[model samples]
Target: MTVDQLPPAPAGSPPPARPGAGRTLIRGLGQLLITAGVVVLLFVVYEIWVTDLFGAQKQAAATEEVDEAWAAAAQTQAPQTDTVVVTDPAQLVTDPRERTPTYQTLTGQGFAKISIPAFGADYQFTIVEGTSDDDLYVGPGHYPESQMPGEQGNFAVAGHRVSKGSPFNDLGLLNSCDSVIIETQDDWFVYRVLPMPEEIPTWSSTAPTRPLCADVSVLPSPYEQTVGREITLPSDYAQILPVPGISDATVPADAQRLITLTTCHPQFSAAERMIVHGVLTKSYAKAPGFLPPEMGEA
Candidate 1:
């Protein structure tokens, strides 16, 4: 059995691992991580961009419905006898329960238009009737229990700060004295953001930064403790009362015609709430093709 037929070598341990095997495993892991990142990015895009498109469509449709309703009502509306000429806008609402005449609205119904001049002349959204997520998906939604626009109570509204049209995305940009205009079937109401508590102490030390708040009244007593712009938890229901921070049953007769806007704070996070309060400073009767001068303010 010379070298002509060499005995078969016995099977031994598996071949030593390849030098590039570790690198190959790392590359595969990197690919997996990249894919996961892309998926997460897509989800964010859908939430921020895709949802905005849908929200814009809903807002447009709601705006059209509001326009049509106003036009139709104008043609068929009979003259009202109870209409009282308001010589002073501050005297607009002596009673919190008294509201300007408006057509009845259902949940998710569009009843008004809100424009923040600080945002831009073109920035406007139809104000809907309820605060449900479904209602806010269209635009800023009114708290059903709160007073209507220009009423003597809080005209509370809520909107998404990051998505779904993001009507209130720049709420942080609005400081004291900025105007928030609301239009109804027959009237246009202008509300000026109130001064923050810090500013209120020095509000009179110098001339007001803007003329809107020059004659503005400060939040009284209990409300004085509340800031014009506040960060709070979602459970603060008193923020929407007739007189903010005051009990509904104990709302003073002189309760202000205030407007409160709420949105998620810190943008893209719902861990807290941001609120902005305003007071009605002026009101105008709606006329054909006439917009209030405040609408152009920034």
Candidate 2:
């Protein structure tokens, strides 16, 4: 057959393989994927570390600003009863549980300091008045509608568990009797961590769970123990009550002074919320001299 008419190359003639082009495309794609993966990794690091650094700086500044405000207010006028300084161990300030706390405008305002030795002596953070996202990123944010620290009712607060300084990252470390102290402008309010019973009782007397975390590690805690303690669902608003987990319980007026510390459960996911409930066992006024011995209970 004439060259022009040469039988169309065998039906199975393999097309010339574009090995160079294929390898080039594959190399380019591989690089692109690697670049994307690196970006993702960097973002995660930022969330876990850089954001923490920035949030911590903000928290420190907030604390200083709060102190300055108190100083300014003290100079302008006699300190209010709320801030009355008391040094007598015999005159321990009765927790203001019987009285209704008054907070007019505290959004973004640092009104108090929260210290949990269980989390670390340096675990203290400024507590602002709102629980909104804007409020929590700086540090722990108090439930606006809840009672103020040392107030008779519930003083509930929310915080990040794994990001933005992870203020409540060590929440699971709290055990019954662990001290959750709140240093307000006027007083040092101390609350003891109370056991939160599980919805379902454990088969054994000891709850199956991990021991209270001893440190403020940012990683997810491994609950090595088999405690029957049930993790509360984040949606349970009752968890924040002055008398938590009690729906029909008495209102704040007739209830014990309570404090609730809340954070997203499971470390990273917001699928659930971790709640720590405590009762005010002792309240002390801001004493200029040596602190009460009992106040130093370790």
Candidate 3:
């Protein structure tokens, strides 16, 4: 057939480029990205709001369980208490060994409540017997290896700074001398954050928290009172030492009772850790018809 006379080539179907596998793949990839984005948004929601709600519920239940246990301990009562009257907590409350109530338990169940007035007068959480993932998911978790509250060693705890109820969300806001109280069925353990070393008085040859500082030097160093503090890497475990940051600290003898509060640094990221160190300034025994003055504060 001559060129002009050739039967009009069938207007062939559009070329492959016009509507091909590549276009379909591109469309599919776009859809996948959109779906992925939605999934990420949903996950963030679950991490923030959902986890807090769920954690609040879990903490409520945990507190109930702990309270019941406390009741049992209260009822079983040792009618006798130490003859030593606490005229002033800063001095009288000091007991190098375990103090009144003998409140220490290894069960996963919470045995006490942690109240940080700085966080808020109403802020409180149950402290369960471990810092394991499962333990922390419910509430603030006490390090299994750490000492109990009011003990003459590092009574350390780990909590979530965000999500899982964000129990320690405002931990960084805690200033020097701020109270980090622990209430057991038997006693009220009040610990004041210790100041940084330089902030300590010139008289103390060792860490002011240990070997017992008679003055206000026991409270957190002035540096710690600054609005925002430095973050430490996870590998920096000395923050929980008997005398925080002092690995060779002679605990119980050279060291006074202390508490170490730890949580994730910043907000959502776990890149580093936030640590708060305190000295046991008050150990008021929980007795029949009695509450510490701090607890009574409105």
Candidate 4:
């Protein structure tokens, strides 16, 4: 048939392009891209919001379990009160090996409660026994190799910053001398954040900046490298050492009792880690209706 005489495409049908398939292919690709974008959006929402809900529920349940355990023990043991008169904030523990409140070693179980005054009165979480994914899915997870709370070594903890309730989301907000209180079945141990490296040279001279920070002078030289807040890579395990930054197990006979907190740095990313170091400053024996004065500090 002559070119102009060729039969026309059926009325209302799409005109041919190349082989009558180019338009269909473009439309299919566009639909696929739109669907992929929607999927990505939903995934982000789940990670940011839905995971938080799940974390909250898990934390609540863990807290309840710890409360019950503490209550059961109270029936058998007497409450420890303000018996020890604290004269020096630097020397709260008399014996280096004297550990208070023996801890259980079960993973994924809540054994301790942590409260940060800087994070507000409502800022508290039950610390799980292990740093495994399942354990932290509930709340802050304790490193199994670390020493127990109130011991003469580093008691390190790990938590999520952007998901699973984001317990340490505001860790960066903590300042020197801020209190990080840990509640055991028998007593409350308060650890104050160490001075930032910049504040160290003048820490003693500027005690008034955060009066409590002056107490950090008790820490040995090994801790000089440790700061109130630090950004480090995930591979840096020395941050949790017996004496932070000291890789060996040989802890000083008078090693200071310390607390270390770790979380993903910069939010929503795990490329680096955020480390916070604190030294034991004051400890209070728990009595019925008793509250540590540090808990109310700003």
* Clash count, predicted structure 3: 8
Worst 10 residues of 4 by lDDT: 87-96
Top candidate (lDDT): 4
Q: How many backbone clashes does every candidate have?
A: 0, 9, 8, 0
Q: What's model 1's lDDT at 93?
A: 29
Name the regions of candidate 2 deviating beyond 4 angstroms: 1-19, 77-88, 95-104, 196-230, 246-252, 289-298
Query: Which candidate, 1 or 4, has the higher lDDT?
Result: 4
How would the candidate models be sorted by TM-score, starting from the highest?
4, 1, 3, 2
> For each candidate, what TM-score against the reference?
0.81, 0.75, 0.76, 0.85
> Which residue pairs collide in model 3, if any?
193-220, 194-219, 194-220, 194-221, 195-219, 195-220, 195-221, 196-221
User: Candidate 4's residue-wise lDDT over 1-298, tens digit each?
Assistant: 1222336789898765553466567667777888999999999899889999999999999999999988888866755554554543344333324546654657998989999988988889999999989999999999988988888889999999888888999999998889999998877888998888788787767876655665666355766677888999999999999888878766677788899999998787789999999988777666566778787885
Candidate 4 structure lDDT: 0.83
Local distance difference test scores for all models: 0.81, 0.68, 0.70, 0.83
The stretch of ten residues in a row with the least summed lDDT in candidate 3 is: 220-229
Of models 2 and 3, which has the larger TM-score?
3
**Model 2: per-residue lDDT, tens digit, 1-298?**
1211233556779765544765677777877888999999999999989999988888888889888876675556465556445656668666454434332446887888888776655567899889887788778999877777887667899999888988888788766657788877556777776544442143133424433322111111121111212376877887665556655434544566678888887988879888777767677755555353433444
lDDT, candidate 3, equals 0.70
In model 1, which range of ten residues has the least summed lDDT? 88-97
Per-residue lDDT over 192-251 for candidate 1, one digit per residue giving the tens place of the 0 to 100 score: 888876787787764365666775656677577456798888788888888777666444
The TM-score that candidate 4 achieves is: 0.85
